[model samples]
Target: MNISNNVSSITAHQTLLNTSANNIANVNTDGFIPKDTRITDNAGSVRTNTREADNNGSKRSQTDLAKEIPNEIIAQDATAVNVNVIKTQDEMLGTLLDIKT
Candidate 1:
């Protein structure tokens, strides 16, 4: 199994979810603007020799930073957790392989 794709997809999803959650959490905060998350499919079109791949794009939220800072921190924490999880999983798999050999 190609863990790279899975890891990346999971990370992307976590980012999207975190962004959305942050936006929603601050929906009632004054001057708070929600951020928009978008996934771009760059594979559909080829520009020269480059193959387009989907990239995570973030949009500015209408919510004010005062309200959004906390959520931003939470999002950053979540991203860190996700990265750690992926790394842990990869390491475990590697250990298993070594043990088998």
Candidate 2:
């Protein structure tokens, strides 16, 4: 198992979660441009990119709760999954070593 890739993915997802939380917190603040998190696969690892929009679509609001809330949930879920994967991998490796001993 490639633990490095899982670690990277967890980090990226955490960043995404933070960005979404920030956007939601500043939803009503004037002149606050919300940030969007973009994730991409780089080889076997994950990469994160954040983009700030000049305007929040056609809406007059500074932030869009409809979008930000769902995004935060998605990011949180993804992060949790990655952490579970890493734990599973570690357990499997330990079991293998025990059998060899």
Candidate 3:
């Protein structure tokens, strides 16, 4: 397994989680345009880009709980999967070295 890809995936998911958290945190703020975050991959490197939402005219923030909650859950699960992959790879390496010895 490629550690860099796994790490990049983890970083992307972490960014997703952070974006969701930020949106949730500003749910009650007036005129707070929640940031929309998107994860993209380039040359096997993952990254997150966030942009402010538009079309919100009311004083109340346009943050949606229904969407943010699921986004956070998905990001958390993805991050966990990437971490598990790294852990499993490490274990396999250890086992290989053990057999070598």
Best by TM-score: 3
Q: Compared to the true structure, candidate 3 yields what TM-score? A: 0.90
Give the per-residue lDDT of model 1 (tens digit) for 13-87. Answer: 556556666666765666554565543434442111222223234343354456446645654675576577778
> Which 10-residue window in model 1 sums to the lowest lDDT?
45-54
For all predicted structures, in order, the TM-scores are 0.43, 0.89, 0.90
For residues 1-101, could you state the per-residue lDDT of candidate 2 as single tens digits?
Answer: 78898889889988988998888888777677788789999998899989886674544447778888888888888888988998999899999999999
Cα lDDT listed for each candidate = 0.54, 0.84, 0.89
| Model 1 clash tally, residue pairs | 12
Candidate 3 ranges with C-alpha deviation above 4 Å: none
- Candidate 3 scores a C-alpha RMSD against the true structure in Å of 1.3
The all-Cα superposition gives candidate 1 an RMSD in Å to the true structure of: 10.2
Deviation in Å, model 2, residue 66 alpha carbon:
1.2
Off by over 4 Å in 1: 1-62
The Cα error of candidate 3 at residue 46, in Å, is 1.6
Range of the 10 consecutive residues with the lowest summed lDDT in candidate 2: 53-62
Cα lDDT over the full model 2: 0.84
The model with the greater TM-score, 2 or 3, is: 3
Residue 40 displacement (Å), model 2 = 0.6
